[model samples]
Target: MSGNEKISELDKVLTQFNVFGRYHCLFMFWSFLALASNAVFCSNFVFSAEEVSYRCKDEGFGNDTCTNMANSTAECSEWTYEDPNSFVAEFGLACQDWKRTLVGTMHSFGYMVGLLLVGPMSDRLGRKLSIVITGMLGGVFGVARSFTSNYWLFIALEFLEGAIGDSCSPMFILTIEIVSSRNRLLFYILCSFGYPFGGVLVSLSAWKFTYWRTFLRVIYMPALLFFAYLFLIDESPRWLLIKGKKDKAIKIIEKAAEKNKIKIDKTLLEKMECEKEKSVNFFRLLKMTFESKIILKRFLICLVWWTTSTFVAYGLSINSVSLRGNKYVNYALTSLMDVPANFIILLSQNYFKRKAPLITSFLVGAFLCLAHPFLPANLSWLSLIMYMASKLMSSFYFTITYMFTSELFPTYTRNSMHALCSSLGRIGSIIAPQTPLLMHYWSGLPSLVFGSVSLIAGLITFLVPDTADNSLPDTVKQAEEIGKKGDLKKPAPDFVIDKDKDCSRL
Candidate 1:
C-alpha cells in the first residue's frame, strides 16, 4: 500500500475507536456502580465498629475507653494497653465478635469465587451478559444483606455479594477494550476513582443515617439502577470480533464510524469477512494463560502483584476504622486521599510508565504502614499524614493493576485472564481481615504485617515486563510473539484481523 493509503487506513481505525456509542457510556456507568459497591461495603467496617463499641458500652460489659485501635475494647486503649483478655473478661460478647470479621472474609472469598468464573463466562457469553447477570445478582444480595437478622445469614449474603458482584473486573476489561490505546490507562484510572469517591458517599451516609442496614440499602440502590440501565447497552465489538462474528463486529465498527462522522473502509471489512470460523473453549483460555512458558512467567508476576495489593489494601482500609482517632474523622480523612490519588493516576499515565508508578506506590505504602505504628500518640497530625500516605499508595496500585492486566494479555484471554488475576486478589482480601485479629497477639502488629506485605508486593512488581507504549494485543500468539521477539515497541494501532482469526485470537 502507498503512504497515503496507510494514512487513510490509520484514520479509519482511529475513527472506529472514537465513534463508539451508548456502550461506552454504559461501561462508565457500570464502572461507577462497581466503585460505589466497594465504597458502600467498605463503610460497613467503620459503621459496625462504632455500633459494636457503643453496644458493648451500653451493656456495661465493656468500658467507654477509646483504644488506640479506634473502636476496640478498653484494655487495648491507647491510654492503657492492658491486654485484650481483661476487656474480654469485662465484656461478655466483645471477644466473640468474630462474626464481623468472618463476614468480611467470607465476602472476599465470595469475590474470589466469582472472579474465577466471571471472566471465562464473559469471554463465552459476552461482556454485556456477564455484566448484567453479575450486576443483578449483586443488587439482589445487597438488599438481602440489609434484611438478614441472623449472623450466619448475613455472612452468607455477604459471601453471595462478593461472589456475584465482582462483575467489576470484567466490566473493567470491556471498558478498556473499547477506548483508544493511548487513553486506556487514564480511562481505567478515571473509572476506578468511583471506589474511594463512594467512600466519601458512605461517610456522608453514615453521618446521615446512623444505622448500618439503612446505609447498605442506600448504597445498593445505585447498583440496582445501574442494572436497569445496563440492559440498553450492546456487547463489545472487540469481543465480537474475537468470537468470529464478523458481521456483528463490522456493524459495531460502522456504528462507531457513523457516530464519529467518518467513513469505513470497504476493503478492510471485506478482508476481515474472509477469515475462517474458530471456537473458544474454557480450557483453551486457561491453557493459553498457563500452558506456555514465557506468558506463564508473566501470569505469575501479575498474580503476585494483585495478591500483594489486595492484601495490604484491604488490611489498611478495613483496619482504618480501628486506628487511633474518631471513626468518622479518620474515615473521611483517608477517603479524601483517593481524590489526589486518582488525579496522580490520570496525570502520571500521560508522563510515566505503568511499572514505575505501581512499584513506587507499593514501596511508599510499605514505609507508611511501618511508620504509623511507631509514631507517638501526641503527634496525631503526623500519624494521620502517614495513614493518608498508605491510602494513596493503595489507590494508585488498584488503578494501575486493572490497566496493567488488560494491557498484558491478548484479546482472546483478556477478560478471563484479567478476571483470574483479580480472583486471586480477592483471595488476598479474604485473608486481610485476619491481620487485625492476628496482630492483637503481637506488638504494633497491624503496622508490621501491612508494611511487610507492601514491601514484598513492590519487589514482586519488578518481575513483570514494562508495557508502556505498546499496542494492545488481540491474540495469545501476538502477546507471546512480542515477548519472544523482545519487541517492546509501543503497541501499534489495533489490527482488524479476519473473523476466523479473531476467534483464535480470543
Candidate 2:
C-alpha cells in the first residue's frame, strides 16, 4: 500500500487501543535495556581509586637492611610515583593516566566513526540489525579487556568496546521510534537515568574487584545478556515503511495489535502495493544531517546541549573533591543520588511540559557547578551538596535531550541525526577528562568554565521548537517543511497520522 494508506491503517489500529498505553510498556522495557547497556561502563568506578604496590631492595643505600626497602610509595612521597608505562614496569602500564587517556581518546574516536555508520546503517538496514551488530561487538570487545596481558592489545580492545557499546544511540532511536508521541519524552528521560544508575553499578562492582582490569571485565557482562534478548524484538514499523518494506511492517503491526488484543482492518492488506523504493545516498544522508537548514538548527542546539551536559556532569564527578570524607564515600554517595535523578525526571515529567524542565534543570546545574568552586575549602560538605545538586539537574537535562532529538527528526533521518549528535556529545566527554589537568594549572577554573557552558546550553534551548506538545516527525520533507513554517507546536504533518482502527496493522 501507499504511505498514506499505511499511516491510515496504523492510525485505525491505534484508535482501538491507546497507542501510547499499549506500546509504552514495550518502549519502557527496551529503554531499560538501553540503560543497562550504556551504564556498564560508568559502574566501573568503584575500582577507580584502589591502591596497588610493589616491593624492591636497596642497592648502594646507607641502610644495611637493603631488602626491606619498598620499590614504590603507597602515599604521595615518591618523585617518579610508579611510571607503569616505563620499560621496567612490564605489566603496570594499565595504571598510568596517559595510557587511560589514550584508551579513552581511542574509544571516543570509535564513537565518532560509529556515529556516522550506525545511524545511516540503522536507517538503511533497520534499527534491529544496527543494535545487534554493535551490542554484540561491544560484548565481545568488552569481555576481551579481561584476558589480555599486553598493554597495546588492551587499549585496542577497549577502543573497539567503546565504539561498539556506544550503539545505545541507535538503540534509543529505535526504542523511541516505535512508541506513541504522548509518552516519548518521559520514556526518553526515564531510559536516560540508566547512565547514572549504571555508574552506581560500576561503583559497586569496581569496589568489590578493587582492580581496574578485573573491574572492566566484570562490569560489561550485561551487554551479552542484552544481545541475547534482541532476537525477541521487532523492527520499528515506521522504519519498515521508510525502507519500503510495507508487508514486513504490516506483519509486525498486526502481531502487536493481536498481542495487545486490538483488531485491525483486513482490507488494509489489499492496499499494500504502493510506491517505488528510493535508494538513499551517503551525501544525501550527510546533507540531511549536516547541511540542511532544518538539520543545522537541530545539530547546533543538540551539540550545545550534549557538550554542556557532558562537561557539567563529568566535571562535577571528577572535580568534586569534597563529595566524600574520602573517595569511596564519595563514590557511594554519587551513585546513590542517581536513583533519585532517575525517578525525579520520571515523576516531574508528567506534571510539567518538556521545555521548562529542561531549561530549568540545566540552569540549576549551572548554578550548582558555579557555586561548588566558591564554597570555602574547609566546608567540604557544602561542596559535596552542591555537586550532588548539580548532578541531579544535569541528569534531568541529559534525559530530555535524548527524547527531544528522537522526536525532532523523521525516521529517515532520526538514527543519523541521533548518532552524529551523540558522537559530538562524546567529543565533549573526551574534552571533560582534560578539565582536571587544566584546573591543576589554575584551581577553580574548570568549574567556572563548565558552569558557563551549562548556562549557554540552557539559553540555546529556546532556539528549537518544543516537542512536548506534538507527535514525532515521520519524514525528512515533513521535518524541513515544519522548520520552514517556524512553528514547532503545530499539529503533526499528515505523514505521521495513523489510519486503521483495528490493532491489526501488525
Model 2, 74: alpha-carbon shift in Å? 21
Cα deviation of 278 in candidate 1 (Å)?
Answer: 4.3
- Across 416-440, the per-residue lDDT of candidate 2 in tens digits comes to 7777787778776666655656654
Q: For each predicted model, how many residue pairs clash, with residues at least 3 apart or on different chains?
A: 12, 28
Error of 2 at 221 (Å): 3.3
* Candidate 2 worst ten-residue window by lDDT: 59-68
Give the poorly placed runs of model 1, Cα more than 4 Å off: 1-30, 42-51, 54-94, 260-280, 483-488, 491-506
Candidate 1 residue-wise lDDT, 216-292, digit = tens: 67767666655664556567766776666768867876776665456767786644421121464678667756777
Name the lDDT value of residue 144 in candidate 2. 79
Work out the TM-score per prediction: 0.82, 0.80
- Candidates' C-alpha lDDT: 0.67, 0.63
Pick by lDDT: which candidate is best?
A: 1
